[model samples]
Each structure stands twice: as C-alpha cells, then as structure tokens.
Target: MIKGNLAGRMGRMGRMAGDSGPERVLVAASFANRVGNGLFNAASALYFTLVVGLPAAQVGAALTVAGVIGLFAGVPGGHLADRRGARPVMMAALAVQAVSMAALVLVESWAALTVVATVDQIAAGAGGAAWGALVVRVGGERPAVFRAKLRTFVNLGVVLGTVGAGLALAADTRGAYVVLILGNAASFALCAVLLLLLPRYPVLEAPPRRRRWPVVADRPFLAFTALYGAMGLQYPVVSLLLPIWISGHTEAPRWTVAALFAVNSLFCVLMQTGIGSRIESLHDGGLAFRTAGLLFLVSCPMMALAAYTPVWAAAGLVLAAVFVHSLGEVWESSAAFALGFGLAPDHAQGQYQGVFGLGFSAGQALAPAILTTVVLGLGATGWLLLAVLFAALGAVGPSLARWGARTRPQPAVAAEATG
Candidate 1:
C-alpha cells in the first residue's frame, strides 16, 4: 500500500515538472547535497568529540555561537544574489561550503572548530537564499509544489545518507569518520558542478528610489514571519524535547524516539507534495497553517498524557502523537512554501526568502533553550501552554496574510496590463 501510494505521488510530481531540464538538475543537486548533509550531521558530533577531543560542552557552545553569527548572513547573501544573479552566487556559496567542509579535517581545537563551523553555517544560509531565488526562476508556475517535490527527494536522500552513516558509526574509527566528512565535502563540490549546467538567470535590478532593505521595512511580512517562526517551534519539539520527554518523563522505551523520527521522515517523503499541491494561494496557506496549529494542539497534549500512561499505552500514545504531529509538519511546511513564495515579489525573491529564513533559523536556535525550560522543566502544563501558542498563531495567520497581500505593490498587475 505504501509503495503504491508513493509511486503514484512520485508520478504526479514528475508530471508537474515535466520536461524541465533545470528542475531535474536542481532536484539531483539538492538530493546529492542533502545526502552529504545527512552523513555529516550524523557523525560530525562524534568526530568532533571523540577524534578532535573537544569537550562536549565547548562543542555545543561553539556551535550555538556560530549559529547566532550565521543568522546575519542571509540578507546580505540574498542581496548579493539579487545584484550578481542567483545561479553564480549559489555556486559560489556551494564552493565555499565544499572548502569549509574540507577544512574541517584540519580542526584540532575548539577555536578552529568554531571558525570552520561558523564559515560553513554562513555559506549554508547564503546558499539557501540563493537557492530559493533560483527555484523561483526554475519552478515554472507553481514553485511551492515543485519545492515540495524537491523536499520529497531530499528526505529520500537523507535517509540513504543516514543509512550509509550507520556503517561509519558502527566502525567507530577515525578513518571512518574522516571518510564521512570527505564524502560530504565531495558532495558539495559535486553540487556546485551540477549547478553549472543550469541556465543563467538575469539579475533583477532594483527600482530607483526603492529602499535599501525593503523587506526589513515591510511590517506585515515581518508579522507573518513571526507567526511562521512560532509554528516552527514544532521542529525542536520533535528533535530535542520529545526525546528527552520520552526518556526521562515517559515509560515508553528509549527506542521510541528513533521510531518517531522515522515516522516523521517517512510521512514527509510520501505526503509532502500532495499536501503542498493544495496550498496554491495565500488564503490556502493561511488555512493550512491553522490546520497545522490545531493538529499540533492535539498532538502536544497526547504527548504530555503519555507520561501518565502504562508502558504499552504510553508507547502507543506517543506513536499516535508523532503521527499527528507529522501531519501538522507536512501542512506547516507546505503552507510556509506557499506564503513565503506567494507573498514575495518576483525580482526580490532572494532577499525575501533570506528574510523569511531568519524566522525558522531563529526558532531553531531558540527552541532548544526555551523548550527545555518550558516543556521539560514545567512538564504537562507547559505542553498545554505551547499548544495554546501554536493555536493562537494559527488563529491569526489568515489576517496577517491578508494584510501582507493588501500591502504588496501590484507590479504583476501593472506588467499584465502593459503586456
């Protein structure tokens, strides 16, 4: 049943981007890139701690500081893409990433590690913004749907990479870890080369008299970003808080954490495109966000209640909660793609996406400390409060979206009339 469903969905995605050479190239590059990322993510911490001999606390602190610094890279990166063209900027970012990843091999101390990690994170942020702009050029009429398809391939690639990483983990040797790191570096180089095959997109010149940072001055979009960031709290809930919550608070086996992650990944691979297809407009995006919030509300309490259940029941409840949460994740992701792409002007997609990325990055960075305090320290009540937060964000999403839409300059309308 799963195979049939996935195959059918894959078929639909293929037809959606039929005969688009750039789209195919982009998907292949993204898949390759993600596979490398998965390998690095799985083994990098162990490599740093065990092989490089950095203290775990120091490693965490360095990464946190690096992430904070990297947050500032997006806007400049996007602006550069707008000025110099996204394709070349994206290739440049990938090249930097390849160099940074390769340089990781030379890091023997905390300071070296921090420097390398910070550089890699900045490149990633910039590359992401440029990639968003490139997608806008290549994604034909429905970029969100195309991005959803890309995400499906991304999940598949990550799964494949993680499976490969398992071998290195089992080996538990410096040689194996080095191989993983080098493999990731090679993938970045490969991605850069592949991007060269893409057609050059013309750089969009900003209008005379436009503000230097229009997105910063856009109040309604910023409000939307805030709510989107709030919705993104689900990420750390799954990645950080849930595992701790399951292990320390609930009677469910420790392995349930892995099981839940597997469920979420599988759901994304099979269902993302389908859900994304439904979110074609800002109104649809708003509705999707609301639905996601409500689903999270349902799942959060179920997760909390699992702490009080019997062993078998606790496991069952947690599994169900994760399933529900995965549904919400799919909806939230699809909605975000729609709103993020739809609300932005065609010429400013890079900068707009860069600005939009800030919210998610901020949520990811803050979620660890905030969730640990609220969900872990405060317990079930904290979960309820979190649920209320998501619900409120969802409740207001439509109004926020409408306001953004109303405020946007109707360049498309003028172009349409002139054409």
Candidate 2:
C-alpha cells in the first residue's frame, strides 16, 4: 500500500510539474549532469592534493587560471547553437567534459593539470552555453515552468552526489578517489547519451549568424542583466558573507553557520520550482522580480541585526533572514530566467543566454570581494547600506522587465529574422 501510494503521488507530481516526454528527458539529463558536477567538485581538490600529490597551491592557481581562460566560451557556443542547433552543440560539449574529467586521474604535474583543467574549463563554458540553448529549444513559449522543475531536480541530484562524495571521503583511499572521479565522468557520459535520446531542434533557417553581440546592442536588456547580476549577489551573501560575519563579529556559535546553510539549501530545494512555475509571462516575471526585491528588503535588515544580538536571538534572526533571502532568490531567479529567455530574438538564444549568463557569472566572480569589503571593511552600518542597495536594485526589476516588454520582438518577427 505504501509503495503504491508513493508511486501514485509521484505520478501526480509529474503531471503537475509538466514532466511530459521531452521535459522529463531534459530533467533526467540535467539531474545526471549536476550529479557529476557535484561529485567532481566535492572530490577534485582532494583528488589533486592527496591522490595525485600535486601541491594544493598549484591546484588552486591552475583552476583560477582555467576559470579566467574559460570566460570566453559562452558567446561562441551560443553562435554555434544558432547555426548548428542546441542538441548537437550540447552533446559535443558534454563529450568533451566527460573526457576531460576522466583525464584528471592521469595528471602527475602542474603543466599537465593545467592543460587538462583548461580543456575541462573550455568544455564547461561551452557546455553551459549549449545547455541554456537546449533548455530554450526544448521548453518553448513558456519554459520558466519547465525550468523551475528542472532546477529543483538538479538540486536533488546535487544532494545525492554530495552524499556519494561524503562516503568517498570517509573511505579516504586513493582508490576511492579514482572511483569517484570515474563515476562522475560516467555520469556525464550517460547524460550525453540520454540527451541524444531527446528530440532535436534544427537551426531554423536564417540570415547568417551575426558575429556582433545582440545583447550589447539592446540597451534595456543590458541594464536588466546588470541589475540581475547584483541581485545574484545573494549567493555569495548567503554562503560567504553571512557565515564570515557571524563567526567573526557575532555571538552565534560557529556550528550555527552550518545549520543556517542547511535551512537555506533545503528551503530553496523545496520552494524554487513552486515559485518558478508562477512566472507565466513578462508581467508575471516583473511581479516576481519586484516581489523578490521586497523580500530582500526584509531579509537584509534582519541579517544586519545578527551582528549584535544574543546567541539565541541571533540564531533565530538568521533563520528568519535566510528564509526570506531564499524566497527572494527563487523569485529573482524565476523572473530572470523568464526575462532572459523572453527578451531575446529567437535565433540568437545561444548568444543572448550566453550574455545573459554574464550577469550571474559576474555576480559569482565579483561578489566575494564586493561583499567582503562592504560587510567587514565598512562595519555594521555597511549592513544597513547593503540592505538598501539590494532592495533598490531589486526594485528596478519590475520596471526593467516592463521596459523589455516594449522592445521585445514579436515571435513571428524573431523567427523570420533568423530565417
């Protein structure tokens, strides 16, 4: 009876989440891909330092260099998606990543490590571009709903992979590391195979793919991307800044950081898709974004107060802060995905999403330094200012999305321009 009930519930969820044929395929493949990513990231540093015997410093340096080098990958990948279609580009990119990931087991020196890492980084950059293009290709018209479900599944995959990583770490043997690495590579390979099983979207016949960046030419889109990038700072804020502030400046126990992060992650995993599904159109996207800004306004000040509170008070406030912060993130992300996908000309999805990716990427790359300088360098008042900053920036989303609606191309026009 329990098994049947479980199966029945799962079926109902699939229906609600739009897990139709292609959507299910995309979610399955994405879940597989994220599992590999989580496993590799969890093990990569340990694999390099402990198993491969490279110095930890060299590993960090190589990865940093590779990250810098890989920054250029998304734009060209997008153009290729426009020319060759999303599936082929995604499959080829995944194949490259799989090979590169497996090759990590063979690295003995920094030079070799750098080479392999760079190849992997390039593939990752291209793969991310291709992945975005594939989502656009597969989801069609109203993808935010599908994407929300996909993101939720992706988080579940990460949780599963992280558990695998923890078990590997507990085993603490070179052999265990090798298994983890190979297993991650295999997951990537399997995901590519599954992607191959999905329906293909041929490049709609169009004018030669433009070499010029369309996103840059569109001013409102650029502004929106910039603001979206700042909003994305919530990531570093939640992960890095809050933890650092609590440990260094507040009365909260050090372990409290872990507890708070658990809450944040679990909240996101539970609520992200539900929030993401609500963004049906441009106006809905605007409403979500605006709503996100208001939530940020609430959360930011709560976090700021943690600096001086008693242990019990601090712990409770931080929980409240992150709960609000997590919701803001859901709204911001759902809105951004809708806007990012919605604002572009259809033929240029690869390029557009690539550029749109810049917003989030910039936040990831820059937020640590920016947040650290603000929260620590400037002191408590900095928190108040940050609250205002986040709120103000978020407030801009609805209007910007509204503006995008005015200039966004008609579906027929976008289709023909590509033709």
Candidate 3:
C-alpha cells in the first residue's frame, strides 16, 4: 500500500511537469535573451552618452526613428510569418538580431548605431508577432494558462537578466557594454536552437490573392487596437520618466531606483500565476479594461508624493505604484492577447495581429518624444498629466470593451494540429 501511494505521487508529479509542454523550453530561451537584453538596457544610455559621446537628444531621436521602423515592419513581418512558418520566421528574426548585435559591438559611429537600432527594432516586431502566434498554436485550449505560464517565464528571465546585468555593470560599467551586446547575440542563438525543438504546427501562408495592402477595417478591431496603442504609452513613462523623477527627488542613491524596478520585475515573476488564476474567469474585455483603469487611477497620484517623502517612504510609495502598475499590466496583456488571438475572424488572424501591432508601433514611436516633452519640459506637472492621461485612456477601454461584448460572439479559435 505504501509503495503504491509513493508511485502514484511520483506519476502525478511527472504528469504535471509534462503538462507545462514546450513552455519550459521557451522560458529558458527567454531567460537567456532577457539577460543580454537587460545588460544592453542597463548600459545603453551610458554607452551612448559616455563612450559614443552622442547627445541625449540625438539618442532619443534615433529611438523615435527605430519605433517608426518597427511599426512599419510589423505588418510585413506578420505577412511573412503567415506565408512562411512561424518557426522559420522566428529563426530569421533571431538571426537578424544576432547579426545586428554583433555589428553594434564593433561600430564606432552614431550613424551606424542608429541604423542597426532601427533594423533591430523592425526585427523585434516581426519576431514578436510570430512568437505570440506560435504560443497560441502550441497552447491549444488553455491559452490563458499558457500565456500566464509564458509571462512567468518572461518575468523570470527579466529577474535573472537584470541581476546578471547589474553585477556586470558593477564590475566595470563602461567595459560591460561590449559584453552586453554579446549577451544579446547569445540569446538569439539560444532562442533559435530552442525553437527547433517546438512541435511543428501549420504555418499561416499568404492568401492566393495578393498584391494589396492588408485590410483592418473592422470597427471593433480598430477600437481594440487603439486601446492597446494608448496603453503601450505607459511603458515609456515607466521606463524613461519615472527613473528621472526618482533621481531628482529624495537623496536615495541611483541603485535604490534600480532596486525598486527590480522589485516590480520580481513580483511579476512570482505573483503572475497566482494573480492570473483568479482573473481567468473574468474574460469580459470591459472588465479587464476597468480593472486596468482602477490600477492606473489609484497609482498615478503616488508619483507626485515621491518628492516630498523620506527615502524609505518614497521607496514604499514607488513599490506600491509598481505593484499596482503590474496588475494592470497582467490584465491588459491577457486581454490584448485574447483579443488578438481569439476575436479576429478566422481568415484574418494574421492581418489582425499585424494591423494591431501597427498600433503598438505607433505608440512606441510616439512615446519618446511626447512623453519626454510632457515629463521633462513640465517637470512634476507632466507626471500629473501622464497620470490623468492613463486614467482617461484606461476609462476608454471599457467603452470599447462593451462594444465588443455587444457584438456577435467571436467564433471559437481552432488550434493548429501539430504534425
């Protein structure tokens, strides 16, 4: 009796492990990629300003161009993915990224860096669509769980990557830039290898009739796309604006701000699954938007308080704000994924993802300038404006969601059968 119980327990554990599927492999790949990406992110600004000696404004301008390139590239990338298989498209994206990173390490001029950055951004967008679509293909019916699993994996990647980057930077921040570039290249190679192991699934190829722009004229789809674009604006505020704000206020060292950001990443890694589980039942788009709105509305005001507060107090407030922001991140991400994968017409899935990604690209392109103008030009006043903007935009999500809910139910998604 005892032996049987032990065997049963072991079998169940093994089954649970296997059920995670290709998710584990993807997670490992993402971890390596993020480490290299994180290293770049941690040091890139310094590299440009200190080593490359480019003006901050110029760097910003180049990023804006990169965003534009990424936006334009998304549709073509998706089309290519649909025409080719996701696996092939993904491998191509990785190869582009790897080559670009290697060139970046050797390049001496800002012009070359700008070109590489733009091309890399385009590759990123293409790769992103293929990856997300592939996940949907592999996930079968449990997409939410699958997405949650992937989110956790990505977050775990962020944590490890950030830690590794931090340590590398600490050793010799200036010398580490080359290593950062190399790290990113390594990730691409790793991802390419792992992708080969993923089960073969039907690829979305271009339609028989071509020679035209992809159409995304559906009203509900447009609305969803707009909401996603608006929400994407929040990322720059967090990444670019918030750090500057933290530096100006409070005597806390720079590392403190990095630590706070790290906390956000850590929570995303640990709590995503638990949080995702509870919200799985609330599939209504309107509810998801409302939830996101509440988080932004409640958290944005906390930013203004950072200037007046003590170090510990400021840290606490920032931590709370980050946590709230992450909740919205999870909900918005899940909602966006569901809408992109599930809501689009069966024949138009690739087009839907492409066009919607265009919206994201638009937001990404515009954010650096608009956000910088508001936050840097106006100071704390701009942050308040951002807060209001987030709240208002979040409010807009529900109306869009309601419209979607009222529309005819989207047809069930058919999983591609693996060969």
Candidate 4:
C-alpha cells in the first residue's frame, strides 16, 4: 500500500515539474543558442578590431549592411519552411549558422568580415523563422506558453554566457577570442543535435502555388504587426538610447546604467512566466498590450525626471523607470507571442510569422533616428512627446487586435489531387 502511494506521489510530482519531451528539448536548445550568441556578441567587436586587424568603423559598417540585407530574407525563409518542414529548415539553418560561426576564424580584412557577417545574418533570419514555426508544432495548441517559457530561459542563458564572456574579455588574447568564437559555433552544433532529438511533427498542407504574398493581403493583421513593432522601440530605448540618455542628458551616474540593465534582466527572468500566463486569447493579449503602453508612458516621463535630479535622486528615478519599463516589456512580449501564434494560419505559419516579424525589424530600424530626434535632440519635451506616443499606440492595440481577429484567413489546404 505504501509503495503504491509513493509511486502515485512521484507521478504527481513529475507533472508539477512540467517535464515534457519536445518543450524541454526546445528550451534547452534555445538556452544553448542564446548563451553562444551572448558570448559572440560580447567579444565580436573587439575581436574584429584587435585580432582581425580591421577598423571599428569597418566592422560596424559590415554589421549594418548585413542586418539590412537579412531583413528582407524573413519572408523567403518562411516560404521555404512552409514548403519544406519546420524541423528540416531549422536543422539546416542551424548547420549553416554553425558553419558560418566557425568560418569567422578565417576573417582577416573588412571584405572578409562583410562576407562572413552577411552570410551569418541571413542564416539567423531563416533560423529564427523556422524556430517560431517549430514552437507551434511542438507546443501543439498553446505555442505562446512554450514560446514565453523559452524566452525566459533564453534570458537566463544569456546571463550565464555574459559572465563567461566577461572572463574572456579579461583574458583578452587572440587565442581567447578564438576559443569563445569556436565555443559559439560548437554550441550551435549542439543545438542542432538537440533539435533532432525532438519528435518531428507533420507539416501543414501547402496552399496552391501562388506568386503573390498572402501575408501582405492581410491588411488588418499587417497593421497589428506594425503597431507591435513600434512598441519594440523599447528594446533600443533600453540597450542603445538609455546609456546616452544617462550620460549626455541625465544627472545619474554612468554606473547606474549597468545596475538598471541588471534589474531589467533579473525582473524578466523572475516575472515573465507569471505575466505571460495571463495572456491566452486575442482579447487578453490586446489588453496586455494596452497595459504595456501605459507602463511605457509612465516610464518615459519618470525617466525624464532623472535629468533634473541630483545623482542619487536621479538614479532612484531611473531605477523606478526601468522597473516600469520592464513590466511593459513582459506584457508586450506576451501579447506578441499570443498573437504571433494565434493569428497565423496553420498552413502558412512560417510565412505569417516572418511577415509579422517585419514589424519588429521596422521598429528597430526606425527607432534610432526617431528617438535621436526627439529624445536626444529635443530633451525633456521630447521625452514627454515620446510618452504620449507610446500611450496612443498602446491605447489603440485592442481595437487593432480586434480588427486583426476578424481578418485571420482560413487555413488553405493543398488541393486534393483528382483520381
């Protein structure tokens, strides 16, 4: 009797632990990949300038060119995944990226850097599209839950990788750089192997061959995507703009920047899953997005307050702003995932996700110049303007999502062949 009771208890415990096959593998693989990426990102610029003997400007130019070119490949990548299968496409992309990372050792000049970077960026876009489709396949009906969980783990992995990268930076030798680079390549290889271990799901039936972009035809969905992308400006605001905003504009100490980022990362790791769980349907997701906008509106003006305060007071305000901004980030991410999976047609998931992703790309591309003009160029008034902008966009999200819900296309099946 006791043995049976213990066995039952163990089974229940396992369920509570949330142990599953495919989601586990996917999360583990994502962790490895993110860690590798963090390592590479931490060292790549210094590697290019010091070890590869290229100018910093040349490296930046190479990256910018690669990013721009890769942005256009998302749609084609999705198309390829739809025609083929997500697993195959993902594995192939992983293999290509692994090879690209390994090949970085051979780069010696600006030309070589440009070529290598371009290839790497293209593979990254394809891999990203494939991975999103795979989450849908593996998560079965609740891909957003799986995706949100995956993101949290990814953040944890990046943190660990960043710690490792700090060590590499301290070592700062050509040999050390080579090791980190190769470690990233090896990590991708491991990710590919892990992906193959997961059960492969069947592909959705492809639609009849068409030259036109179906995703483009979905106008309301496109608007939703664009709006979400605009919210993505928060990314640049934290990573790119904030440091400059602090040093150039605010009275906060420069060291507070690191502290602020730490808070953001920690908050995400701790709070994302909790916040993500509440976003289930399109309505819930839209509400979360609206909440995110309100948070942003409050955060920006609070951040503006930092500029007029004393050092400690400014730091306190910035810290508070960071916390508020991070909540919005979680909300935005949760909403995006729900909509990303919920709204996309099953047969055209890859293409839809790719197209939807353009909003993120567009937001990233546009934020720099736009923020520079208002936030930096105009100062406090500009900050207030940015706040209003976020409020307006977020306020409109629910309506746009409702419109999007109406526009979702019926899944187009591969027309059955006549006998």
What TM-score would you give candidate 2 relative to the actual structure?
Answer: 0.92
lDDT of each: 0.87, 0.81, 0.69, 0.82
Top lDDT model: 1
Cα lDDT of model 1 by residue, 116-190, tens digit: 999998998998899998888888677888888888889988988998999999999999999999999999999
Candidate 2 per-residue lDDT, tens place, 139-217, comes to 8766778788788888778877877888999999998888888888888898899987788777865446644567678
Model 3: per-residue Cα lDDT over 111-208, one tens digit each:
77789888898888888777666666666665556667677767777667767777766776556777876887888888888788787777654456
lDDT of 4 by residue, 138-218 (tens): 877677777777788888888888789889999989988998999999889999999988886777785578434677778
Instruction: Report the poorest 10 consecutive residues by lDDT, candidate 3.
Output: 410-419
- How does model 1 score by TM-score? 0.94
What's the CA error at residue 395 for candidate 2, in Å? 1.3
TM-score of 3: 0.84
Q: What is the TM-score of each candidate against the true structure?
A: 0.94, 0.92, 0.84, 0.92
- For candidate 2, the lDDT comes to 0.81
Regions of candidate 3 where Cα sits further than 4 Å from its true position: 1-20, 52-59, 173-175, 204-215, 249-255, 277-282, 310-312, 375-385, 405-410, 413-419
Q: How far is candidate 2 from the true structure (C-alpha RMSD, Å)?
A: 3.3
For every candidate in turn, the CA RMSD to the true structure comes to 3.5, 3.3, 4.7, 4.8
lDDT of 3 at 391: 72
- Name the regions of candidate 4 deviating beyond 4 angstroms: 1-19, 206-212, 409-419
